[model samples]
Target: MSVTDPEPTVPTRDQVRQAPKVLLHDHLDGGLRPATIIELADEVHHELPAGDAESLGRWFAEAADSGSLVRYLETFDHTVAVMQTGPALTRVARECVEDLVADGVVYAEVRYAPEQHVTQGLTLDEVVAAVQEGFEQATEAAGGRIVVRQLLTAMRHQARSMEIAELSVAWRDRGVAGFDIAGAEAGYPPTRHLDAFEYLQRESSHFTIHAGEAFGLPSIWQAIQWCGADRLGHGVRIVDDITVADDGTVTLGRLAAYVRDMRIPLEMCPASNVQTGAATSIAEHPIGLLTDLRFRVTVNTDNRLMSQTSMTAEMHSLAEAFGYTLTDLRWFTINAMKSAFLPFDERLAIIDEVIKPGYAALAG
Candidate 1:
């Protein structure tokens, strides 16, 4: 009699790397190469906490792991400081695409605040143009093997949401795919940028909000019910609205039920969440529960430099922690591709042509 093969539960690091991935929440500035950061910092005369690339990389990871909110936020100062020039932005953006391609990402949307990069005399339009140039150049270099887009981000604590939202629309036909608002979420809510959200919705634009992360369910509610976000950045706190009893029965609250029912994509960043104390660890991250409950869950690397993570690392760690098979990883890839702000035809093409066949080969 023919015997059945053992279940394929977890994948190896190399197998994870070979799988074509889709990224929806990576930050352009947050994933700069350590050596590139050093060179750019020296050219701009910016003082970094560490002089060497190896030491500087350690400094970023350590600062994020320090458990201090100030230190964690301060880590971006160095990355943002060096990324203030047009060429600097181009180089960083190009390198970001290259890194993602090497990590087996077939599609990605890298985000950055255009206003933040204007300190070095580059206009908002110039910043966007420079980044798009990098993406184009890198995609050309990759020979149509990858597709990358930009998501213009507005700082939540700032008053430029409307401006950033406009920029997103202005560049929509260009390389910009969507808009997002990110920053501290406590007193500053998504409703503060209601005009921006409403404007995007009116223009038939797509956007996501950084919600339910450092804050709680109310932030998520504001982003969804109030601002009508297409997706949730982090959204880890939505788990707070869910309960499990001693008998292993589970119940979802109104907001949680609404989120799952609506199939709102949660751009869950496990490593970055742990670094910011939103998650205790990879194993304890809410992605597992969300995935099990059939929520629209997609894994992402919010800040690769701070977390020292890549798509391969994130997938491999999840597999190690949750015993996720290649089939599970394919679910995440397809989820991200479907949630992408790219045109629906392009999204479908990648899922059917790239993700499905790649996973089938890996599983075989």
Candidate 2:
């Protein structure tokens, strides 16, 4: 209820490992298993900065935590390089699903830029098809447990936004659930791709734009007002618009009020935020404040490998930092599930059948 109130404590690490969580903001390239990355790199003759899986994993964690967005982005260059061919893409995608299933993620939407995977002469369609095939195979192999969806992303600095948006719409009913724009958020505003957003709007396509991460409120304003983003990726800067009065009462600016009033989901990635210099520390994260204020805040792992985090780890950190209880975790999980691009009926079914019962069992 209140931020100062003691939450209903749950053994989150143990319970959450089997609690049927929903992941909404993970990047497929960012979630690659280190061992898989090493093997894939060998297949493509890609020279990795680290030779061993342990060191390679540590290298990613260190590079991302270096507090420079440019350097953090550079790590993806290697992962993306190895993912050029069909088999490589399929293997990574399939393994991603398996990893999520192992982590107790019942439903997940993995986002990746299809354009980035076509460097080896494969078409964009081929990339999407291959990833979809991998997801299907993984789901089957997972014994019908985890449900994975693909969200096609367009690189922010690129000029192919409209093409990627059209591609997302084209594959809407075929495993692709939504569209997104990611990459450097400072100079490349979502407004630069107005044509793509307009096309997606007309096509009734779903989209979540990367905003309020490396940039500030202006980027978020443009993403929501100009580009009509359904959800915000790491909207931590929204806290910039909120202030507290001398008497200790909180005040919301026009932009913060609008976002809260509209119930636009904020995909807040705590560890990733710290890694990207978005937030200095987890204790000072706006997630606790936003959650207290009821802003449709949801936890996510934007880049698992880079941040060296899992959904369970993120939740555990929040619990340790803010003393969140099982109820709080359940609320966040439901919030993410509700905000997902899945059909309303299907989303409700998961909430009612899977998530609710799972959390109830945890509480018991």
Candidate 3:
């Protein structure tokens, strides 16, 4: 009797990490190395919740998992405090790119607010320059293996949005990919930054707004309709527009229908959603429904340090929860690439060359 050996099977983590990925909603300050944070904090005399790198990393994870938005926002204070000067910003940005490269990310757009990093006597322009320099340094160090872009972000509650928007426009050719507005969504809505959005639109620039995570459909509606967002950040709350009948019929509300028809991308961060109380668990997350319905959905790690997640971990969790295969993971990667702020030709080239071939080899 001839017996066939079982097919090779390894942890999904290995497969997911080997796949080329595209990330569009990551935060620079949110992805720093724990040891680097401690060192930087030490240089600046900034107080930290934990003394050692291991304890500090665990502290961030636990604090973020507390299910309190207030506590979640509090974590950034520590990270942002350490990233004040040019060298500190350069180190963080360089390490951020190196980390993404190690995670097998072929392309990433990291967003940060220059206004937040200007408290240490550096001009907003200097902060942008420092971060760009770091990105350049990382690119050389990677031997040009990865492509990194910046999304100059403006805090929604702050008054420097127009300035940030203009800065993004000015740096369009110099590593800045687009503009973004991020902050607490409860009291400060996207509408508060209408002028900034209008300016970006007029300049033929791209911008994504944080919406539909902590808030509801109204926030998403304003981001898409009023603000003309190119994409939705953490748009998990858009699930409210979807209804399932007892008879197993799925119906899309008008807003949902519009979003699906328009092919708008949803930057869904499953781990971050769970940490922020957006969803009770990954199994119950709306990503499964949205993916089923063929929405333009992209998986992202919104805050790596806070969520204690990477692309590999996020894909592993989703695969375990939803029974995803290499094909499903490839679909999410392609969706993100197609929705990237890069030009159509560049996005298409990566999808056709890197992403497609990389997945094909793994799928085999």
Whole-model lDDT, candidate 2? 0.91
- Compare the candidates by TM-score and give the number of the best one: 1
Error of 3 at 8 (Å): 13
Task: Score each candidate by Cα lDDT.
Answer: 0.93, 0.91, 0.91
Predicted candidate 1 versus true structure: per-residue lDDT over 1-364, tens digit per residue? 0023244668899999999999999999889999999999999899999989999999999998999999998999999999988889889999999999999999999999998999879999999999999999999999988999999999999999999999999999998999999999999999999999999999999999999998999999999999999999999999999998999899999999999999999999999998889999999998988888889999999999999999999999999998888888888899899999999999999999999999889877
Lowest summed-lDDT stretch of 10 residues in model 1?
A: 1-10
Better of 1 and 3 by lDDT: 1
TM-score of candidate 3 against the unseen true structure? 0.96
What digit string (tens of lDDT, one per residue) describes model 2 on residues 1-364? 7344344564558776777788999999999989999999998899999999999999999889887767787899989999999999999999989888888898999999999998899999999999999999999999968788999999999999999999999999999999999988877989999999999999998999989996899999999999999999999999999997889799999999999999999998999988877788999998988998899998899888999888888988898898887778888999999999999999999999999999888767
**Model 1, position 270: C-alpha lDDT score:** 95
Q: Where is model 2 poorest over a 10-residue stretch in terms of lDDT? A: 2-11
Candidate ranking under lDDT, highest first, comes to 1, 3, 2
Q: What is the lDDT, from 0 to 100, of the residue 112 in candidate 3?
A: 95
Sort by TM-score, top down from the best: 1, 2, 3
**What TM-score does prediction 1 earn?**
0.98
Q: Model 2, residue 138: what's the lDDT?
A: 96
